[model samples]
Target: MLICQLSDLHIRPAGQRYQGVADSNRMLGDAVRHVQALDVRPDLVVLTGDLVDHGHPDEYAYARELLAALTIPYLVMPGNHDDRDRLRAAFADHAYLPATGPLHYCIDTYPVRLVALDSTVPGQHHGALDAAGLSWLKATLAQDTVKPTIVMLHHPPFVSGIPYMDAYRFLDAAPLAEVVGAFRNIEAVLCGHVHRPMFRRWAGTVVCACPSTTTEIALRLAPDAKPASFMGPPACMLHRWDPAEGLVSHISYIGDFEGPYDFY
Candidate 1:
């Protein structure tokens, strides 16, 4: 099974730009087209939060319009910038989402099982998994131990070296780590809060953070580095899963570039 992960879209209302600079809406459309044109179409696509610049219904409407171009199945979760109720109302047709509550659910119909967690803290920028969420996760994981599972959440559970980004990092992650670490069947933990692509070995598995489809946060490691972002090449994460070999991931950049030159 091939899973395409698109993160941090930050889509704005039609004709508007994100942060009054990045043409996030257009970029998201391009990213969607890029995924559609993939030689080996992905079996599913997951959007890891920040679906809009603000929690406005107009933004969500435009976002839904932009995403309607996708022909493949997709799932979405809320981020710090999103309003849970508004998001839930926007994607009301997606039955996997609960009628009212944290947008957490498990999809087991495919070869790989997907357990998505809601890590967003409403009206705040930091992330946390409350006791109830952790309990739900523990119970969910206990259901099937044999299936190769992928855990999805908006915030990356580990501290990224970038000081500025780490400021809003996942809080109360110790319990989450303990719960996930106990599950040996989990293939990976996928996240998106950080705009740049990142990977780390965590909780007896791997955490893969997908790059943004729009602006990318500057990779500054200094303790006092000022927060900054750039219009770096947008990209997505392609996770290919095989029962025999497990899951392999790659970064699929969005844009037209010179490539495919024969090396003969």
Candidate 2:
């Protein structure tokens, strides 16, 4: 099945410009349009995290509007900037998010089983998996299922090697690693918080981070760095999976940037 992955929408409050830059909410709108324009409707849409510019109700309201434009059933969780209560209130009807408890849930639809976990620590920028969260994850993985499974979260369990971004990554991930590492059925660990695309192995499984659909974190091969002036080609990821093909990922860059757009 095809799963279109969108992350770091970073939607701000209506009319609130982000530091004299383009409307992040509008850029998110563009991403929705692009997804709608896809030839094959993705079986599902997985929104990784950072759905709002801030944890404000107004920002969530704006995000709620923009996210509703997609026709596909989508799932979401919180990030450092997200307020869980506000997210739950805004999308009360969403299945995976669950109106209460763990801020985690699983979806099983014939060929695929997807798990979305809440990695955001309340009032913090970095991430961690608490005892309760770890217990639930271990139990969930214990279930016998032949369908290919994927676990999605907001923080990358592996270091992105970008010094500044790495500082805010998942802090207590071993409990998380033990659960995922023991699960032979799991295919990949899907995440998005770094605002950059990445693929690497963590605890015997693959960990991937989807790039933002709004402003991207500047390619910081340098230390003590920050995201650049916010004007960059926005992007997202598409993950194609099959029992035969396993898992493959693609990075889609959207917007005007220095490119040939030409034929050889």
Candidate 3:
């Protein structure tokens, strides 16, 4: 199965730009078109988080229109920038989302089961998996220990070397680790929030944090490095799964570029 992951769209209202520079709406639309034109279309598309710049109704309205261009089915979770009520309401057609509560859910679409966990802390930039979220995850994973499962969340469970982003990393990883460590069927913990693509091995599983579809966060690893972003090549991650090969990810950059010339 081919699963495409798009994160941190940061969509804003029409005529608005993210951070007064990046045209978030246009970037997101371009990313969607890129996927649509792929030779091997993704069976499913997962938008990790940051679907909007602010948790505004108008922002969601615009996002809804932008995502409508997608040909494949898509799933979304909340990020620190999102409002739970507004997100749930915007995508109300998705019955998996709870009418009221954390927007955690389980998808049984393909050979792999998708477990989406909400890691957002309202009104805060940092992330955490509260007791309720942990409980839900444990129960959900226990149901099919042998089935290949992928856990999707907005906050990555491990710290990235980027100091600015690490400061707001997920806080309750110890408890989360214990739960994930016990399940070998969980192939990967897919996430986004750092606005940079990253991969890490944790608790016998892989953790992949996808890059933003708009701008990218600079990869400054210094202890005192300041937070900064740049308008680079927007991209998304495509995860291919097989019973023998497990899961593999490939970065698909958005927009036209130089050709893949022969290397004679």
Instruction: For model 2, name the residue pairs that clash.
Output: none
Taken over the whole model, the C-alpha lDDT of each candidate is 0.94, 0.82, 0.92
Return the TM-score for each candidate structure.
0.99, 0.92, 0.98
Give residue 191's error in model 3 in angstroms: 0.4
Regions of candidate 3 where Cα sits further than 4 Å from its true position:
none
Question: In candidate 3, where is summed lDDT lowest over 10 consecutive residues?
Answer: 255-264
lDDT tens readout by residue for model 2, 215-258: 66777867767656456567878888878889888887776556
In angstroms, the error of model 3 at 134 is 0.8
Model 3: how far residue 129 lies from native, Å: 1.0
Best by TM-score: 1
Q: Give lDDT tens digits, candidate 1, residues 10-118.
A: 9998999999999999999999999999999999999999999899999999999999999999999999999999999999999999998899999999999999999
Error of 1 at 83 (Å): 0.6
TM-score of candidate 2 on Cα atoms, chains taken together: 0.92
Q: How displaced is residue 114 in candidate 2, in Å?
A: 0.6
Q: What is the RMSD of candidate 3?
A: 1.0
Global CA lDDT of candidate 2, please? 0.82
TM-score between model 3 and native:
0.98
